[model samples]
Target: MAKNLTTLALASLLTLPLIGCMTTNNVQPIATKPFVIDSETYQSAGKSQRIKFIVLHYTVSDNERSIQLLTKGKVSAHYLIMDNDDDKIYNLVPEGERAWHAGDGGFAGRTILNDTSIGIEIVNKGIQPQYKDALKDSELDYHPYKHFVEFDEVQIKKVAQLVQDIAMRYDISPKNIIGHSDLAPSRKIDPGAKFPWQRLHEEYGIAAWYDEADKQFFMKETQLATPTIPEVKQAFRDYGYQINSTAEWDKASRDVIYAFQLHFRPLKPTGQMDIETYAILKALNKKYAGRDDFY
Candidate 1:
């Protein structure tokens, strides 16, 4: 009886360890309580809207790659407009939070645009694959107008809607609705020549655009004798481009001119000074900055 009883006790002890293991495995984890802060009674009256500029860009890639790059990669944007049949606009970063889209760029008198600007990345395969690596400084090597891809019609509509919405909410000036290339003329050229700026200006009345009359007046004046290179440089600077006082048509000068043409002309961005280009520059300056001495 004693031996049987002892054997029964050992069996029970062995089963007890198994039961404990099962119980431990089935145990529920305790959830942490959410933290809370209350500040309903205080507000500051001396605050202003953080957003001052809206910089636009093209992803230079397909929709999937663009999405992955903007979200997972080091670069990011406040908004991403997909180039797909679906009309989905992804807001990757919050409007209040700064995104890492504008890298080493400045616009107007402002530097480090990522601080005061909201970036919008539109998905498009920018330059064609064959010409992707071609240099842009010389038209003989690569011309953005010839190589760039057109934005989807749906994408343009979406861009207009989004820009208008943000502009209204933040009271952003039309002049502040600029391209990435406009911000960083030297190293960047995006939202390229193929972007329908004229259409946007005509149809939606969105973004900064010059009056045709103003352009024509400047054009006629420039036909007789265009402004000197130094004067043109000052005009570009006055109109908020980061240009230097280099009297000659140097590479930096050409880069800025290319950026301006990319925004205003789109068709003929030769990066060389011509009557039409000068006229457009003068018109833009006169309209936006109210500076009228083009000659």
Candidate 2:
């Protein structure tokens, strides 16, 4: 009995400090008073997600320089995919925080894209001068648009996976999965012609693309009468490009068309409204925007 009493007393003494340190509820001890957060019971139903788009880009430099510029420089992106054999992905900025990647651009009537989109920068040496020189005199004129270097196959797969994950989480529209060039056609042309948008659409089931049958149908109509410039501009606008109905094929219009062709018809992005280009545009607007009539 004496030995049992001694053990009980020792245990009581050992627990005294802990008991004294406990909160009023006696659940646990806290070093200092803490602000209580009540998250278990109530949540508001009026909230919606802020992320609406994903904008892709190419860094146009080596990996080291790409990281340096994105991290230290004025411009930044949420993610960066290096073009190395390992195909590493770096989260440069958090998705919740707005990166300065989308500057002076809008998409599908949404302006200030930086607030509503996540940007991904892939390290690539864009548009080698030798390639440009070779294409300059070729009959396959892509005048304002040039062939950008192809992304590493491994790098592209990682990009597709990242995009898939984000899009699934945010429920972002396939049409809103776009390139830097798509957002600001006049000022930017990145994730350029060689970005393999078709591959992403076909293989990964990512991004919006026109139906081949729809395109073929529109192609036949192209032989009737050429679509007017204003009509073409309106088609572009309806298809989510920030093009104006300026009534003529101006430099700005050409730039926007170049951006479009860079994504869709990369082989000959001449910035000219040919039969093929018109048909492609109409097909896209019809499929994506729910427009039945050709412009």
Candidate 3:
């Protein structure tokens, strides 16, 4: 009976540690701060849609890398459209959440667009390697070599469908559909010259397009009297570019012009204030200037 007691005591000692370990592992510490839930019977009178703009971009990398970067890295996009033969469109982030695609940019009268924009990242090598090399040499102009790969037709169709659905749901304006470069002229140049803005404008009505007759008339008038730099800068600002209304044709002004030409006169984004570029700017501003919807 005494030997049995000794064995039982040893077993209890061993079991006590196991029991303590189990208790330690299973129990979770309670939070110190108190959280309360509240219910309201009445709703606020004034509210608006969180989403205001749809900003487009090109990943400048392959589809796989683009996905990995956007998902795992600090930068992210709401949607990523692949350039593969399949033309797959992937949703990386939910529409309700803000994506980090438009890092530091603005449009219309609003700054920091990431707060109010949905970003779409399309897979495309923004510039060919040879073209990039030629650009550094100064011996080659962008006209000869293809600046970017053409977007697949199926991909564009899918984008249009997605845009249409989102626009309908959020009541986004056609003018608010813009490229990343348009918002961040100083920093970004994605959804570059090759992006089919005209096609999107004509077919899907995603963006605004100026009338051809008006553009031609303005182009002709520029020959007689070139508008001052300040006038052109104000026109650009009125068209929603975040350009300073400086009288001089400074570097900042040129950069804004580059962003404009990259969207409108893509073949030659010379960054110079020329007749064609000025005409397009004037036409766009004349149509969209001082609209209450933009802000």
TM-score of 3: 0.80
Model 2 clash count equals 0
What is the per-residue lDDT of model 2 for residues 52-88, given as tens digits with 9 covering 90 to 100? 8999999889999999999999999999999788846
Those runs of model 1 whose alpha carbons end farther than 4 Å from true positions after fitting are 1-47, 133-144, 290-295
Off by over 4 Å in 3: 1-45, 139-145, 290-295
Whole-model lDDT, model 3: 0.82
Across 220-255, the per-residue lDDT of candidate 1 in tens digits comes to 998888688899888888888888787898888798
Q: Which stretches of candidate 2 lie over 4 Å from their true place?
A: 1-45, 131-146, 290-295
By how many angstroms RMSD does model 2 differ from the true structure?
Answer: 12.7
For model 3, residues 1-295, the per-residue Cα lDDT tens digits are 9999999999988767565557765776566675655558667767778898999999888978988999999999999888776746789899999899998778888898889989999888888866766667685433231666677787788789888888889888777888998999888877888888888889888777787888988998988898888788878877888988667877777778888888888888877788999998888777765542633
Q: Would you estimate the TM-scores of all the predictions?
A: 0.80, 0.80, 0.80
The alpha-carbon lDDT assigned to residue 88 of candidate 2 equals: 68
**Minimal lDDT window, size 10, model 3:** 139-148
Candidate 2 or 3, higher lDDT?
2
How many residue-pair clashes does candidate 1 contain? 0
Q: Using alpha carbons, what is the TM-score of model 1?
A: 0.80
